[model samples]
Target chain A: MKVRLIDLYVAFLKIGGLTFGGGYAMLPMLQREVIDKHGWATIEEVLDIYAICQCTPGIIAVNTATMIGYRKRGIVGAIVATLGEITPSVVIITILASVLTRVQDFAVIQRAFGGIRIAVCALIVQSVLTLSKKSITNTGTVLLFLASVALTLIAGLSPIAVVVLAIVAGLIIGKVKERRAA
Target chain B: MIYLELFWEFFKIGLFSIGGGLATLPFLYKLAETHPHWLTAAQIGDMVAISESTPGPIGINMATFAGYQAAGYPGGLIATLGEVAPSVIIIIIIARFLSNFDKNPKVENAFYALRPVVVGLITFAGLKLLQIVVYGEGVLNGRAMIAFAILVVGVLKFKKVHPLVWIGLGAVGGIFLNLGG
Candidate 1:
């Protein structure tokens, strides 16, 4: 059955609406909506889509919207899906910017922001834990993790350098693993 | 003229921002430096706060907000479009390759390798954000810090808890207990 444009739009809308923190936190919700609810994508596809989004430039969530939407419809599907993903931000932020300019001094607003920032941190930490649990499965991955954290955090190495090195390292490791399996 | 400049500026931000949404901060700061009229340092801090808490991608939210602040709704629209264009274009070109891309040993390995890096970048981003939130101004107050710890523990107790629930609880706690201010 072909999913209607509006249905696709609504799906992203719901995903974007419920999502807080950032792109990583949105993945579980995205999987539930796109895979479990609609069956537009499978688990493996979702993972690969996420990987692709990670490697590419721009917002991961918006890229997810484009890629998943394209899968659901085509190019047009991508646009509407992106629009759906961003609509909430546009509305909410626009309202915030206008209204916050006025009452930003209010103690309650500061307190609320203080509260929200903590929750955002907790969610981000949860995502970090989930990823590490999955990725730190081998010695090589462990070394890579430590090296990466050092390069990025301590040395202030450019993230792109870390990404490029990881790709090459991954290729070598993947090949070695494949040879062993074969 | 200003809209074109906005699009071009954000287009560059979208193009080079690697890792994830948090990576956009430096580029935004650079923008602020180059164009002081475009945004203030204080505005960027506020943008970070709002983007983190809002729905959609943080990068996109940032582009829209910064863009709006620069040139209203039209600026917001263009900046967002510019920010997202690279990913949309790149994904479209590469996604066709990805279905079978996973089968290739190198592609598979590269992705496996990339996961930790993604995790690393995310962890770094989270900690930095926590540092700012928990210990703003490089000085801490016992009560606020305690409130934060309690909230974190309470949220972490539920295995696989919905993130939205955390957001709601944080809001309620913030309002009721004055955890933030």
Candidate 2:
């Protein structure tokens, strides 16, 4: 079924604005809006799009919106959906940045933000733990995880370079397993 | 000049930052070191707190924050546009020409390995941020450490509570604990 570009924009705008904490939090809301509400894509299609988002670069939520938009209407749909998704962030953060700059020097604001910084670090730690639980499953993956951490933390390799190495390592690992099985 | 630089830098960030929103933190850390005027080590912590507390993807939120810090509202717009441009272009190319790329075994294998590595990158970024918040000018901030410990426990125990709540609690804790200084 064809979806209107305006409808696509509004749908994604709601998805972007309402969801909090980003990442997986955006998924269920996304499933509801596109599948149940708009009928833009089916469950299987959404899952496929989601998987594609995972391996690709950029933000997963934005990528998912782009792929779905492309499916619904084409390139223009992709642009519209992506714009809708980020519009909220651009507007909200811009406003926050402007206002915060004015009063940021206040002692009270400083103190509050000090606490907020702690909370932010805790949040990242939580994310690391949660991501590790899912990604570092078996021995090979565990080694890959450790090697990556050491490469960046100890060897001081750039993350982009490490990403490339990991891809090559994965391919070699996959090839060796295939050879052994054959 | 700054506008172009912001756009170019964020464009690169968009292209390379994989896995998820938090993945951008590693690149931002590098960027902070290179362009401390645009974003300081201390501000990175603020950016994280603000980005997590607000709506939308943290990556996009951060791009906006950095852009605004660099060149005001126009910079924010440009940086955000630059960040999303690569994703839009790449996704369109894949959707139009490489629709089955995700199903390719080679691609599958790469991602299988890439996932754990991305986790590592993010962990490294998290540790860096922890260092920034818990340390002040080559010395440790004991108050921030206490707040970090408490929040870590709070987050683990109340896994379902929205992060905003925890952030709010942290703000209150910071004030009472005299963390502002």
Candidate 3:
């Protein structure tokens, strides 16, 4: 079944406009709209896009929209989805920029922003938990997570360095496992 | 030509700052140093708060807000376009070779390695934010502890509770508890 470009724009607009949390927070909503609501893609396709977007540059949610849109309607589809995804942000942020001082100066707004920050922090932890369940499946993955956490948190290693190292580690592990199986 | 500068600056941020939105923070800090007019350190913090609190990707929010702040609405649009330009191009190129994209064993292995690392990245990002929100300011002080506890408990108990609900409750507590800074 074909998906209309307009539908692509509208659905992603919903995801972009409504999702409060960042990229990871956008995942479940993306799943709901794309897979459940519009039948745009399957579960595996979404996960594949997730992985691809992570390794690629740009905002993960925005990149996901680009990929899905491109799949649905080629380059034009990609543009529409991306525009839909970001239009709300541009408008909202532009407005907020104008009044950012007024809001920050307000006692109530300050406190509210602070509270929202903490809650957002909690939500990030929740994302970490959900993601870990799927990624940390074996002893090797467990070790990677531990090493990565220590390197990033305790040792203050750059995340890019960690990502590169993980890629190399993955290749070595894959080669070793292939040899063992053979 | 601040618009041109905004476009160039954010285009670089988009191209190099891999690992997603939060990853762009360090570069933004550096930009604060080099181009203080684009965004100040304090403004960066404000941008993060506003970006996270509002809708859309935090990266896009930062870029758009910074652009608007620096140049104007046109700057906002241009900066966003710059940020996403690399992504649109790269995804299109990869999409062009759609079939061979995922089937390669090397690519599969790379992702196998990447998944856990991303999990690690997200965990680190969470810890960093938690430190800032919980400890950066002493606002989570004596009485505010109760609000914090309630949030944690509510989140833990109701796994499916939308984060917006937590944010809303936090907002209410902010006013009631007179949370400032």
Best by TM-score: 2
Rank ordering of all candidates by DockQ, starting from the highest = 2, 3, 1
Each model's total of backbone clashes: 0, 0, 0
- Against the true structure, candidate 2 reaches a TM-score of 0.95
Q: Give the CA lDDT, 0 to 100, for residue B171 in model 3.
A: 73
| Docking quality band of candidate 1, CAPRI definitions | acceptable
Candidate 3 CAPRI classification by DockQ: medium
Candidate 2 residues B21-125, lDDT tens each?
788888888888789888886788888888988999989999999899988989899999999889999999999898888899999889889989999999888
lDDT of 3 at A169: 89
Residue B5's C-alpha lDDT in candidate 2?
Answer: 90
Q: Where does the lowest 10-residue lDDT sum fall in candidate 1 chain B?
A: B96-105
| Rank list by lDDT | 2, 3, 1
Instruction: Give the per-residue Cα lDDT of candidate 3 at B141.
Output: 57
* Clashing residue pairs found in predicted model 1: none
Q: What is the C-alpha lDDT of each candidate?
A: 0.75, 0.88, 0.77
Candidate 2 residue spans exceeding 4 A from truth: none
Can you list the residue pairs that collide in candidate 2? none
lDDT of 2 by residue, A1-182 (tens): 56889999999999999877666779888988999998888998888898888888899899998999998889999999999999999999999999999999988888888888788889888888998898899999999998988998889888889988998999999899899999
Name model 3 segments beyond 4 Å from true.
A1-15, A18-57, A68-77, B1-59, B62-75, B137-146, B179-181
Candidate 3 lDDT by residue in tens digits, B39-83: 665466556667877888889998898888778779889989988
Instruction: Give me the overall lDDT of model 3.
Output: 0.77
Better structure of 1 and 3 per DockQ: 3
**lDDT tens digits by residue: candidate 1, A12-46:** 88887778756687888898899999999999888
